[model samples]
Target: MDAETLPPHVVRTAPGQYEATLPGGTLRMSMRQEELPLPEICDFALRHNARRRFLFVSRVLGRHMPTRPAAMQDVASRLADKISIDPADGPVLFVGMAETATTLAQTVYAAWCRRGGQGLYIESTRRPTGGPIAFEFVESHSHAMAHLVHLPSPEDDPENLFTTARRVVVVDDEATTGRTALGLVASYAAWRGIAPESLRRELAVLARWMTDAQSTESEFTAFHSLVEGSFEFVETGVFAEAPPAVPHPDRAGLARRGTRHGLSHPQPLPWQLDVSPGHRILVIGTGEYGYQPLLLAADLEARGAIAWVQATTRSPVLPGGAIGHVRSFPALSGERHTEFLYNVPEDHGYDRVLLCCEDVLPPLEHPIHHISRLEVLPLPGTLTS
Candidate 1:
């Protein structure tokens, strides 16, 4: 099979089972929404795990796939529009899930603010911050189970967003069991010594499972997603066990700034490089530092440069299915695991590739520059005071 070939669309493999082929195995997805645009918004990929086998590779997430910054912004803005927060209820708080939803949360948060919504934004992170802790919880099915939320700096939230917030919105790319979001809501309520019912809570996601009424929260928290659906995966072949989770890397000399600690309507870092009109450009983000790269790319697109954005991720996935191409690079942060950048096919024909980083800038002679084939330039991320 050609690596660049997309997976077959949903096909009836049994009486009521519709299956799609993946590099690891076959998956069955049964959706609830009318003519759910699964194929349009996402495609299927395979991940080896006892808990889950299929990965919903989002086409516009700029995580596993290279996507236009405008497309990503439109999808995020639409999701933001769905989130309704009453002003009289008090200040709102937005929590972007770690790793994957970090950029999406920030994009949506920015859109919400542009519409005149007042709030503070923070993202859950796996990195260690030896500062005051806000709350911590677990995503049981995740390869990395534990997640930490850092307490917002008083400078970022002078009005006390967390203490006074009456509405809390947890954003993620997708929700399966919805346990992670609920767990976060519970943890937040407990940390603040407030009843869960007292706060207006919502889960904002691009897609989610709604099987057997699983879409609805058991508590007072509301749910919102672009698509509501259920999926069942029956493995059709034997596969390797998922590799051990990556250990936290040492951030000793890295500049300490970003959403993990807190940022209210984060400003986009300037990209000093000059780009001309009609030149195809791709801005690649490094690990969790995805949102800023996206902001930079969006700015480039606005300035008439042909630009798209994606990120290097630690996720393990097969090369076929939704993933057309994969490039492995040694961990820049000195972590043991290999990092991957996917879906940049040989024919992508981009004039330039900008690899944006927050920690340390690599020399121009790095292997990634050669491996990617395009002119790879290292760009700095957000600036800190």
Candidate 2:
């Protein structure tokens, strides 16, 4: 059966009254939905990460035409509240996690920066084809071991961008254990010689879904107070653990379909093509669809194509030199007509450019059109062929 014809239990449900069958007994959730309007909190927690399972499937950012600026603002405002810093407290450095959270983090940074404080936006990325690296680190669960961060020169730093800025807001989609943020704090503290307690660092996310038992909030606080100085976290509602594994007809069918096609059934991307052996292909993704493109790029690499992936987002670029994980590329829209300028020289000269995501479209003036063979990969469920 097609995914759409699957049983109701297989589809995602709205956050409201719902019945779920558990191992020992039945579980139900009955609570009034409360809206949280903190911009930073929303940006970091709600929108930063993409939906992991079938339980949640909506994409919040520019994936749809009407970009929710208010949603972005709500997250930024909450993050500011957590830090207890005035919106005008100079420029704040906003660093986003890799892949999915890049745009969401960038939005929070823009909101924070627009409020009289300069905003410096940086996102983490695993693609290492081009761009100068200012720093590098490792993400435990990621397939890529090395993450490269690119910061602009000090000359490009905005008036408010400074290493000694009172607040450095670290934004992620979700803070499950707060370990990622804590690791970030430890890195900054060690580098600056500021006690974790003395270093004014704040953490924010779109949702604080992970329970305290799963997170290191208490441990982080204790470590900072004992090892350094102080740190704080601002978040929305704590999330409960996802429902235990229930039979998913859609996933199972997809798995079966893959085996028939000689593809790795239900595993990320089944169809992989080697554009050319040893040739590097860059697949750029849109906001919400970033992770899928990254996965496909990796799969293509495994199939013998040197692949690099990056994403374009709606977040405003800050006038600073501090770098984040993902590299900011230009979108094809608007008056500049310089969108193709952001394409990496090493990437543009590739044998193929497999553009993924439903929203990504070729530019009118694509530089690669004349140089390389371009192909489009339609996302599942929406594919006609």
Looking at model 2, residue 50 earns an lDDT score of 20
Model 2 lDDT per residue over 1-385, tens place? 2435422332213433333322122223232322431121211111121222111111233221112334433544555444433554554555667544655555555445445445555555443324344555555433223444554445444452535544566776555466666676666555557776654566666544344356466644221110011112323233345322212111111111111111111124435554566876767554324444555665666667776665554332221111112233343322121122122343346666666644334464644344356676655543331
**Candidate 2: lDDT over CA atoms?**
0.42
TM-score of each: 0.88, 0.45
Instruction: Note the Cα lDDT for every prediction shown.
Output: 0.75, 0.42
Q: Write the per-residue lDDT of candidate 1 for residues 117-169, one digit (tens) a residue.
A: 88999888766556777888888766666778888888878888878888899
lDDT of 2 at 170: 71
Prediction 1 global C-alpha lDDT: 0.75
The count of backbone overlaps in candidate 1 is: 0
